[model samples]
Target: MTLHPQSRSERDPETHRAISYRTTGSGHGAIVRLMSPSDLGHLIKPFVFLDLFEGESSFIKGMPMHPHSGIATVTVITEGNLRFEDADSGTGMIDYGGVEWMRAGGGVWHGKEMSPGTSKRIQGFQLWIALPPALENASVDSQYLESGAMPEAGPARVILGAYQGVQSPVRAPDGMNYLLVTLRAGESWSYVPPKDHESLWLSVSRGTLAAPGLVDAGEMAIFEPGNDAVTLTALQQDAVFVIGSATPHPYELALGNYSVHTNPQALRAGEEKIAEIGVRLREYLRQPNDSASVPVFR
Candidate 1:
């Protein structure tokens, strides 16, 4: 179903999608909550939460271990780098075009897997997708793909879905596409969604753009719901942003503090699993964490 579509503007609707809603979102410290499950999420469904974060002065060295279930998180680094270490992936830097995908299926506790990199300034977006019923309680799966490992299509990196016959290495679920794109000054690019994927939205991280209407840096805009392609011009400066389109999630968003499930029954089961996992996680954290970083604790 199309959501809060705006009245057609005079601009060529065939070339660019009109904006239905836009927000800079609320900011706390260096992180801006562009979209959350409780706000502006239902309209975007599977695409539930988004955060535009930049650590200017000093990035947090380590984030405390947290739990999540019934969702998958995709992290993209836009400005700087973050250090990632895992026993399977070893050590690497996640810079622009790099990605980290974590499916917190069933239940998982993680955080220290990534520490501060050499860059003093860091910026990126973390997006959470509500899991489908079958995969909601599946086993945890994580992938840390370096910039070189990710596929690209013209000006965009296929972050989590196939584009122009190129596919991302990360094994994300179907019916959604996430892209990280950069347009040089005066450059133009268009994004055509996959079949049946109606939900679409985007957030700018740097420079200004005109998807026919000005979408300045640091703003998130929800497109009038449809499958029409959107062409973006980078105005007079280079523009960098992340765009997402997906099939609307059909389940109710049953949420807990750190989890999202399809129904109340699933949420209760997920919460119980995380609570049990937390007890063991406290013990796991007490041990020396000096070896390789554990990317996921299921």
Candidate 2:
């Protein structure tokens, strides 16, 4: 099952390509970095920002209240629980290795606080998936799924996407899926995309994964649209990654503090809804990231 044994295409490079990550915010309590989706835009159709967060709480406790709209955010906790509450959604906690998906279709107010009385190190990823024009104005909804509830096939954990004849419990819009994969040392796995799938991208979270050449942690490996199944081998005791997507939902993305959409008009509309939600609930909105801020991409 070693990737080394497979006959790699003559035009392909022999090394696993590293995905560049730009450090955004880091302190004693946490490290925040923006994984460059724009650089690998062609390989990753609609998904963006494989944001990685580590360390402790920096806020008076942790991240305060926030608002969102027009996109779905998938939060996977691997090490510590994340305490969250909203004016209407009620309060809840997502434990270690848990996954919480928030679809801010039209608007929503959400907040995350650290587990009370504990300064546990929280490690997780927030994957941003753009909604199609149709769902862009849909109602907002949130689903919290425990880690054990996610489907697992062999060494991989089916987070939200499908792989190897196994599908995730948390179905996504437009046939898209995102999966968390972990391989024991010396173990290997292979998966074929659904017949209509248009692309596949793999991002290693920890340890070394062999795909023709070894791809270490923090790197992204992309595959061209083809009929062949992808094969990956673990070179270390534990290799974890996020493998996902189904149909290619490619679109021109305009990223703002609280929204990921196709145009400025859409972003403006999203913000208006977010404001309306906050005002209706008597809650204050977190300032949106300045649209004029410098780009983090190279």
Candidate 3:
């Protein structure tokens, strides 16, 4: 059956008018930046920086450690799996539908927490969220939830927020919803945004979709600002994608090398904390006796 077709009402044309902006981000390697703070991020704050990544075990295992602060990173696995071995977080495999949420509050260094899993090829998306002022410099927290722990509302796995009364296990911020949805060939679905959620966007990881218009794999599209529902139809093969909607972030973004803050003072504080933690991170990783792969220094 057709979901929310545009014929609902004459006054609903603009609300369900497909998309207004789209992009296939530029990159030469196994990863693509679908949205960044410099580009689509300005249009959608809080929800900033999105990466679509796919790489082999060798590449995934060799990822260098990195540091961040004043923001949180959400990693959703779309295919294969990654192994997380740490004394604190324990050991487990994050496969399709699994999500890892790391709040780089105050400051922290990571990247080695996850190594290549049983799958030779792993693919997923990493999203960076600019935190509110109160949480920007708060304590660091991390959550690793596997597929079975995730909840679904229809075809969508609630990744970061509530949908149709189903709430994700990831304790993300309020005012935003992120979902990972899969549709069989020729299936149609409708997404109704929550109250006051005006920012809307989606990125396709596989196959094609018609929000009444074509959105091919590897491309991201932005819906025109409104609190309305969008109808999506899988065109050819199975469709896998992530969608997000939120209330606009109200603060100016103060950018740093690996941090985003509400203002210059916050940025400076976060960077300072990150730098201090980086020194300890290097020492921990270089130790011959330390077997802990996932180390959090703040």
Candidate 4:
């Protein structure tokens, strides 16, 4: 994901500093790459890539199988629904507030895991977090969580980390937090980062938000490092968004078309594992029932 810089002439009243990114896409679907490992992602590590996507259910189903390594992907649906299938979890429906977590530790092949639900159109975001050195080459794991299974605090749902004493069930690593929030029009909320959680950013999925500067829908804002609480006011009815905070990742990022690792050696290992899994995935798909568990690297 390439990030073209936007003018930063405005500042949030509370913090008195702000950085913003505008949504850019091909226009075929309302798809946007809000952050990437190269740009804002360098500043906000652990939380690496973020893609905001919405389209007809039929179109989404056409997505081809892809592979990833050295990262964990979080798929959150905000509108419509999707069918999630795996050998371990079987099949489940993911609607609003539902989550699909895939830890492509060493390697994994996916894309056929999700299909259109009952809705005609679907909207959602997929986020990638770079795994730490200890787990970057671990085996793959997955989970499908319904809305009722996720815990909420006030207007925010604890998606990845703890918030206000409520912990998410995602089994994510420590030192990072992700939340999905909805604020009624004219309402306000404040987020105070935990100690050492110096990296903070948010992207709005609908309506407008005022973090001092008015951030319209489809925009993302990165806050300056500080302990100052960030305040946001909804400029329209039911503004929905996701925010993330984390401790800076300590290792350098070794990039690949479909993988991210902490070093060249790890990158090579992950890609080699991916090649080994690809053959198995193809064979599994040829079976009639095709209920085999996704290959996991040990």
> Per-residue alpha-carbon lDDT of model 2 for 40-153, expressed as tens digits?
443555676566666664432545557776688888765566665443445566655567777777666665422421445666677777787777657876777767677777
Weakest 10 consecutive residues, lDDT, candidate 2? 289-298
Give the range of the ten consecutive residues with the poorest summed lDDT in model 1. 1-10
lDDT (C-alpha, whole model) for all candidates: 0.87, 0.62, 0.85, 0.81
- Could you give me the TM-score of model 1 versus the true structure? 0.93
Off by over 4 Å in 4: 1-9, 12-17, 20-30, 285-298
TM-score of each: 0.93, 0.75, 0.93, 0.91
lDDT of 2: 0.62
Q: What is the C-alpha local distance difference test score of candidate 3?
A: 0.85
Give candidate 2 regions above 4 Å deviation: 1-29, 32-43, 57-60, 84-96, 113-119, 225-227, 280-298
Q: What would the per-residue lDDT of candidate 1 be over residues 75-176, giving only the tens digit for each residue?
A: 999988888887667788899999989999889888878887888899999999999999998888898988999888999999987889998888899988
**Model 3 per-residue lDDT tens digits across residues 84-173:** 766567879899899899999888888878888899988889999999999999888898888999999999999998999998889788
For model 3, the stretches where C-alpha displacement exceeds 4 angstroms are 1-15, 290-294
Those runs of model 1 whose alpha carbons end farther than 4 Å from true positions after fitting are: 1-16, 287-295
How should the candidates be ordered by lDDT, best one leading?
Answer: 1, 3, 4, 2
Best by lDDT: 1
Residue 295 lDDT in model 3? 64
* Model 4, global lDDT: 0.81
